[model samples]
Target: MPVPRPFPPRPFHGWRVVQAAFVLAIFAWGIGFYGVGLYIQTLSASRAWPVAWLSAAVTFHFLVSAGLVALLPDWHRRFGIAAVTRAGALASALGLLGWGWAPHPWLLAPAAALTGVGWALCSGAAINAMLMPWFDRRRPAALAMAYNGASIGGIAMTPFWAWLIAGWGFGAATAVVAALLLAVVWPLAGLVLGRSPAEFGQHADGEAAARPPPAVAPAAARDRAALLRDARFIGLSAAFAIGLFAQMGLVTHLVSLLAPVLGVQGAGFAVSLVTVFALLGRTVTGWLLPQGEKRRLAAAATFVTQVAGSLALLLGGDQAWLLLLGCALFGIGVGNLLSLPPLIVQAEFPPAEVGRVVALMQAINQALYALAPLGFGLMRDVGSTAAAIGLALALQVLAGILVLRRPAP
Candidate 1:
């Protein structure tokens, strides 16, 4: 009796759901998001299409996804997450094929639209919705863990796509990757996403029994319409949108900016380093995030770090070590920007309204980020690299200010 040891607790099924969401994010971000630049380059080279025309298609792809993502909550409510996810996989597969097969410039419109539809259903909002039913208290950590897949997707897929295109040509590469996406995501959607916490005789966070949902303040909004009008909602959405606008613009131009200083191979490595730092940053923030107002402050601080990084890059100029340092600083905030918004929504809104709020926020961010590349590129063309970086840095500063302006009770 004196030497007795306690039994180990069983693994929580919610963690398994996290794992599934993680895998889903990998493909969603890989093919739909990170692969866009490669698509532009390949289509440009092989089809002899104008880069400007292809870039517009890329912009349209993001805009379409933005519109569709706003409706994601409603779609999931009506059709169910698993079914919607399966449809997304199918759409994504077809879209990838369409990218390679489209013979005319105008054809890219339908191809971009198809990929946009797929991306809307498979990306951030979808991942958040997938995990919402399973974890309440642990939501931050779960999302942080799952969102890392996006970074992993970028790190793994960019080079992989380039290699595939190099070896097999665009058509064969697209077919193979599309096939792999369908094979993995279709079964995954059915297997893991089909079940809920209740199905496994569990409550959120794998609790022993049911507990009351988190308390909402008397002034808290209850429905999507009310949430849309809420000051907090507006503030949160604006801050994230502005921050992401900067992040997306900077990232889209980062390789080109660094190439002048670090050379081609070094520039590519820097971008990969940014993804690595993003993974590390998001993981740390998610695990250590405090509740309530402090969370907003933490989010604001991330923007501040990015601002400093941008400034460093601008001032660092042709100095490789200083430029690399700036990249590290900027990279630290990249994943946090994506992961923190949902956490903010969770903290400010009631459990019932979380899905819609998150969806709307993501929609807003995407709409702005859709324009980021063009906006930044224009700045570079009209002025200089410093001007583009300056524009991003200014927006990030504004984002930090906006986020800290929590609505008064």
Candidate 2:
């Protein structure tokens, strides 16, 4: 296929489509993903649930979310992305409602797991596949912006949830959030997400359904077999796993931990502030992302940030500012990590295969990510919370060291 010289490449309409996707992505991430951490303190206080059990719920949430990503590619191939996302949104609403009103611990755990899976469908695996045809040159930055939606949601929802729980209680809050999601995001997806910018003839792929979309990474590189054999992929994946490990373990109980650091009253504000910085971190790093070699560069940056964030966790203070710094660094690094591996996967595979292959990687690593929290919580059960955090940080340091491979530069 020839690269036709369009008079002005992509125009305003293309940007409109990408912006729509970006908004939808942020809404999904905020309400669906980041919102979970906000509920932990309230849930625990109301039920007197042991941290370990709730930790399992968190693990199970990731398990379901990751499982959906691993499975949804085949689903999309059969049912289409729009259909799957709509179903995901509806399912998520159901799960969220169940979570807010459930009487038993068993009920809440399963409800959270279902929502996790639903989120996986719309936001995790399906998002990139949906946006592939929108813009050519600025996909990563756009994706970065989209992924930052969760951070925004996290920042925004934390205080709102705190207030809702304080004002009307958890049951009413959940119902309100669920109803809003059903009313807002579901309809938006129906209206805005059907056609990529390509359908409008103002995209990198033009209006031709048969035209190839812009590749995810610089494709003028080695073949898959050769690329896999390079060891860089392995190193990068390991480093990313470290970040995921830390993120999964800590984020599950962030509110709980911060309460001790900054009283129960201030914990919500602290978490929200951290999320605000997290969103800034992603936005800033995304702006700094290099045009070429985004894969390796991201791998390197993820290694550094995870290692640094892990080391910084020991810096505790009753004041909110220090804890906020830790969360910001961790959030930014992990958010970018979500976008990074897909770049390599995109480089190595076609657009159709991007979701599936990335799902494969996610399945392998997500299990590891999920287990970190469970294990850490068990250690905390033994009166060794510090020890648990220490072990996680050590593992991250080791992963970072392993990331130092000598590629053919």
Clash-forming residue pairs, model 1: none
Give the per-residue lDDT of model 2 (tens digit) for 56-158.
6766877888766777767877886667878877878788887788888778777877788777777745767666666445666666676676666665665
Backbone clashes in model 2: 1
Each prediction's TM-score against the native? 0.95, 0.80
Score each candidate by Cα lDDT: 0.91, 0.66
Query: What is the Å distance of residue 24 in model 1 from its true position?
Result: 0.9
Deviation from native of the Cα of residue 296 in model 2, angstroms = 1.7
lDDT of 1 by residue, 1-409 (tens): 5988888655678888889899988899998889999999899888899999999999999999999998898899899999999999999899999998887989989999999999999999999999999888888999999999999999998888989999999989999999999898898888898678767778889989888644754445366677678998898899999999999999999999999889999999999989999999999998999987789999999999999899999999789988988899899999999899999888877667788889988988999999999999999999999999999999999999999998863
**Top TM-score model:** 1
Q: Which candidate is the best by lDDT?
A: 1
